[model samples]
Target: MELFAYYRSTSSYRVRIALALKGLDALVVPINLLSGEHRQPAYRAINPQGRVPALRTDEGSVLIQSPAIIEYLEECYPAVPLLSQSLVTRAHERAVAALVACDIHPLHNVSVLNQLRQLGQDEEQVAQWIGHWITQGLAAIEQLIGDSDYCFGSEPGLADVYLIPQLYAAERFNVSLAAYPRIARVAALAEQHPAFIKAHPANQPDTPT
Candidate 1:
């Protein structure tokens, strides 16, 4: 197995956490998103979408997109289940994950912000654009989580995988996590989990010194 990823890519970070939690051994190949390596022709052939977090499975097929790849992992390896067994509970977990992966993360993606700059938005405006969406999303997640230790249960599940990365991205933009105490609490606990610790951006091979 081989994972093409960027250390700071939130999407890639989600997969990294999942892999670690499952105790899977896969070669990690860094894709420098900052330097547009993901957009290069060679990488584009590997992932037509030109995004990081593409996984080459043992079967020789490649999977792109973080959510889909994670689902595949869950299906193929059920030992460390990330989704809940209860039907309603599983749905809610997916919803929470989508809340961050779909609704929030995209608005603040690098390409999206670059488009804002292309349209003449200055640095402050771009930052505000990113913050506004995150603030709204975090507010909703705060309500959804209430006082849960993890997003869905005592153990970190799919929601926690998605939430942790979004929180990391939020801190990068200097977004105030104070308003969402529940999220902050959950994030703090997750940051200490062995799997999460190994998957942290600071610990990645490509992370700059």
Candidate 2:
């Protein structure tokens, strides 16, 4: 298997941690997003969306989208389960994951920041835009994580995967973490885990700003 990824991408980071935790290995193809390598036709052939975190498997098939590829991994390698077998618990896990993936990430993706500049927004205003969504989304997650070690409960589930990446972005933007004690604690615990620590951007071979 091969993973085409941008080292600093939070979405890609989640998948990297997951892969490492499952004790699986994949060839890492680093896409230099800052240099527009993802926009090139050669990379686009692998993913028409021209996005990073594309996973190519042994059968010569490609999997796009972080969540889809992750779900595939969960199905294929269930030994180190990231989900609960119970339906209710799984729903709760997905809910927490979506809160970050669908809400927080899209608001602060590179395209949104670029668009903000296109609309005559300065760096300060662009930062405010990113902060607004992050605080709003993280506030709810902080509350959820406050009562439990993981998203649903004591085990590290899907929510932890999504939450750690969002927290990384929050730190990058210098978002105030004062009000997110629960989140901070959760991310702190996750970082101590070898998989999360090893999969960090700084540890990646091709880390770019």
Best by TM-score: 1
Residue 114 of model 1 has an lDDT of: 90
Question: For every model in order, what is the number of clashing pairs?
Answer: 0, 0
What tens-digit string does per-residue lDDT give for candidate 2 at 1-209? 99999999999998998898788898899999999999999999999999989999888899999999889999999999998888987887888889999999999999989998999999999999999999999888876653677566676778888888888899999998889777777777787888888889988989743
TM-score for each candidate, following the candidate numbering: 0.97, 0.95
> Compared with the true structure, what per-residue lDDT tens digits does model 1 show for residues 76-186?
999999988989989988998999999999999998999999999999999999999999999998888747688888889998999999999999999999998888889
- Evaluate model 2: give its TM-score: 0.95
What TM-score does model 1 achieve against the real structure? 0.97
Clashing pairs in 2: none
* Each candidate: RMSD: 0.9, 1.4
Q: Candidate 2: lDDT over CA atoms?
A: 0.88
In order, what lDDT does every prediction score? Answer: 0.92, 0.88
